[model samples]
Target: MRTIHAPRLLLLLGTSLVVRFGQTLRSEDRERGDVPGWVMITLMSATLVAFILVMAQGALESMFNAAMEKVNP
Candidate 1:
């Protein structure tokens, strides 16, 4: 009579499931069409511009205040 180690059996089952899931995801990704190059470029450019504007917002506010003070004073 042979006895199976329950922990080892569970580990093997879990590993096989993860492998299968990864393979399925890879296959699906292969089947999907890639995003257009221009779309990605535009999205990246917009993101960079937004980040720059957000980072410089404080400086912009101070510049605007200085200009306003010069005009008023």
Candidate 2:
């Protein structure tokens, strides 16, 4: 009898489960009549912009402070 490759078998099983989960999510979204493409795109874009702004907040504050100090001196 041949020995089983446990690691390879587990990896294949995990991949299959993930694919099936994605398919199920897609089907549910279709059934729910999900939001339109344009709306989704707008929402995603806004989220990205918000994230960028948040990440840059500290840098913006430092730049503003530097400019003010120069102007006041």
Candidate 3:
């Protein structure tokens, strides 16, 4: 059995997060109520922190292990 690595997985995950965040911002703009710049900034910052804490570390580790398995197997 093989496992994934770390750096490559983190880079991939970070890229995906940026893309998702962009989509979310676009969706927020389309909502009926207008979002003030400050509020939007605050929300985005908070969401980013939450994403980092909740997903980035663990997910990247798991992805790396999976990738390693594929490569070695």
Candidate 4:
């Protein structure tokens, strides 16, 4: 009786701990901590790309056309 009860008690405790840990993880996931970081990175990358294109539109077009001609022909 004691052995059976002890195993069952430990299993119940372990199950409760696992449930609590899972709840903590879920709550943490609801917070968008890194979303702003990602947004900033995306905006900065887009701005950089726009700046580069504005500065070198002709050069990039010529490079792209040359590469395509080499690949297809």
Instruction: Please name the candidate that would achieve the greatest TM-score relative to the true structure.
Output: 4
Scored by Cα lDDT, where does model 2 land? 0.60
For model 4, which pairs clash? none
For model 2, what is the alpha-carbon lDDT of residue 10? 44
lDDT of 4 by residue, 1-49 (tens): 4554544554555455556545555664667676554554555555556
- Kindly give the number of clashing pairs for every candidate: 0, 0, 9, 0
Give the best candidate by lDDT.
Answer: 3
Instruction: Compare candidates 2 and 3 on lDDT and give the better one.
Output: 3
TM-score for each candidate, following the candidate numbering: 0.43, 0.41, 0.35, 0.45
The parts of candidate 3 lying over 4 Å away from their true place are 28-73
Which residue window of length 10 is worst by lDDT in model 4? 1-10
Report the lDDT tens digits of candidate 3 across residue range 3-41: 555544555565665676566667746554544444555
**Model 1, 71: alpha-carbon shift in Å?**
4.1
Q: How far is candidate 4 from the true structure (C-alpha RMSD, Å)?
A: 21.2
lDDT of 1 by residue, 1-73 (tens): 8776654554555455556545555664654454443444555455556656666889999999999999995
TM-score preference between candidates 3 and 4, better one: 4
Q: What is the lDDT of residue 45 in candidate 4?
A: 58
lDDT digits (tens) for residues 1-73 of candidate 2: 8765644544555455556545655664665453454444555455556655666879989999999999995
